[model samples]
Target: MPDRNSALRGQRIHGQFGNISKEPGVTFREIKDFSYLEITLWDWARDSLRSKLAELLGIGDLPDTGDSQRLKEGRLLHLADGSLAYLGAAAPADILEVAITPEEGCVVPLGHARCLLRLEGPKAVALLRRGIREDLRDTAFAVGQVMTTDIGGIGVLLLRPDTAKFDLLVPRSHAIEVWRWLTRRAAPFGYEVL
Candidate 1:
């Protein structure tokens, strides 16, 4: 795996922050280094490339739009635009090596440009509710669901892999602001940096 060089390299990294309850209700961690590849078809609705897109990425029967599924080597997310985002520990050539002429689709590597933060613990739900206006109840936002939303006016890609876990994909430039926002809200419940 590639060495982890996080966008949030500095600032309040590891160590407990905010209210120190008997037990921390939240634990925040940055997903060190991960691969991010986006495959967008020129004409998704009716394009020959759509069929081969999955083959190129080595994913079989891609997840439904707005849903994410784990792959043998990575996690697959089907975005709202009928595109696919694959995140893994390392970048593979399956999609990267494809021709992907302009007539087919576009492949984008976003590993170095985005910051991935994971918030876990019982209070994670409550903490996220304060910023994201979306309905997060288990019934409303099921696991493996991914959506684009905003927190503190910052655009974010929200992913719910489990009940008490949420992964936020934020732009590199605004990661600190979002971290501060999360820490501030989590203070009341007590948070831990791991």
Candidate 2:
């Protein structure tokens, strides 16, 4: 791990999560607001299992399987592969309880294993083009949509839960590298620590 203290000298940056929604221009910061939980169902589980998980999490109905690419804000997000992730408002209950019954599925907290960065601004979509090749137009990747793709060769879960805002879930090991890539890409757009 690089020395965050030494690496951030003279820069308007903070350790772990950069300035949280403080600076002007595009805001880049590790997301610390919501609780992320990964729920994986068993192979024998039916499609209703997805909704059951949602009800458990209190996010409401799951998007239809055909619309797997769409993600709803403060709702249950169904991944392309049938898995589900919760991007709800409140923190989840004990992981052990959620995962106690293996027949249903398991709830795994991603805070420690993964770090999510939120970038929001008018130029947010443009910045994403630097490393992503997906069609990000509002028509295709509309708000409340999530996609698992590679950014700068790093696997990331890109979520457009809000207008002009993108949440990137990157592995902790690659957080620094991805952050550097994002900052470099946003330089011309006048990015800030926040």
Candidate 3:
């Protein structure tokens, strides 16, 4: 079997601000520990809000139901209630606040937590399943399904934003170990550690 690191020999890295790294053809951005903010919208205004969010983030409008596309360049804005919204992003320093109204529910700010691990490659799916419990079969966990499950005995937020790729969320402290595990598991299949 090829060495895990060798497989990821040349790939561009794409990740958040802090964890950015230079890989051949891989990009690793550190988007862990983002502040969570909740916003409430008025009735029948969710679509408008979604539109505004997409525009602000440079992505397509969100669908009426199901999950939103993973913000490739920005943070995820999740609206939990009608007349309410939730925003979470990785900020450098002070937390950002957006004012809404009492009748519009609430916009609560959550503290820093969670680590993000993105694996991109043809063999990514096969490698990820080695440590995760959720069924990764195409028919079962289709792309865009966000699931909270355990991976290698660790809690993880698994998102299959697209085929041949995955975004994993875990506690920040275990990021390295998880990466190592993923690298090691992917070896047999020519897994690369980008």
Candidate 4:
């Protein structure tokens, strides 16, 4: 039998956000505690696949206006040809896959393939404006809106689920560079890693 005290399988595959201060200001951190899954539906399978996923995940009808929906505080990320969902820390891809099949869509595990970072607080928008050229005014990019744009020259999926917050998703390879760029730009205003 496996040692009960030993680290569980897949534990090390998860990312880490070390030593973030709680001091306040623009608090940012890599979200290392959630499960990420991407559901890519084949062209002809889109409608049926979405219905099945909606039923299984208990996510009521998907959003039609924006590319994301705040479901129970988390989110269901819609893409041009697929969708991504964020689950609780204890939720595993296997559990998500149980309700899915190859005929409908493909379930991609993004836990190690991508990194999600969350920025929130008073200066969050300003901090992001330093890098992205898009108009980020509250009226322009309201909560529950998601757009794919370049930040610090890196292509990223930006989601605004709250007025004072933003979530950025980038490839794992570019996460560190993006984090560095964010902190450097945020330095003008007081910031704390959370």
Per-residue lDDT of candidate 4, residues 1-194 (tens digit): 11122112232223323333544457776676655677667778878877876776677876654467655435677766565555334353556666667886678766666677889988789889888998899888888888789987889888887889888877777777787787777666767764
lDDT tens digits by residue: candidate 2, 1-194: 11122222343384323233544457776655555667677767746675565566555566653132232335456774556676544434343235436676676766556776888988789989889989999998888778888988999888886779998887878777787888877777677665
- Considering every candidate listed, which one attains the maximal lDDT? 1
Please list the C-alpha lDDT of all candidates, in the order they appear.
Answer: 0.80, 0.66, 0.51, 0.69
For residue 78, model 2's alpha carbon misses the true position, in angstroms, by: 0.8
TM-score of 4: 0.77
CA RMSD of all predictions? 2.3, 5.9, 9.7, 6.2
Listed per model in order, the count of residue pairs whose N, CA or C atoms clash below 3 Å is: 0, 2, 22, 0
CA shift at 32, candidate 2, in angstroms? 2.7
lDDT of 3 at 161: 69
Highest-TM-score candidate = 1
Order of models, best TM-score first = 1, 4, 2, 3
lDDT of 1: 0.80
Q: TM-scores for all candidates?
A: 0.88, 0.76, 0.55, 0.77
Clashing pairs for model 4 are: none
Which lDDT tens digits does candidate 3 get at residues 1-194?
11112122232232322222332222233444345443556675555555665576566765333243555433453323352222244441122233344453355553334455677766567777778777888888777665667777777667666776677665656666666676556546553333
Predicted structure 2: lDDT:
0.66
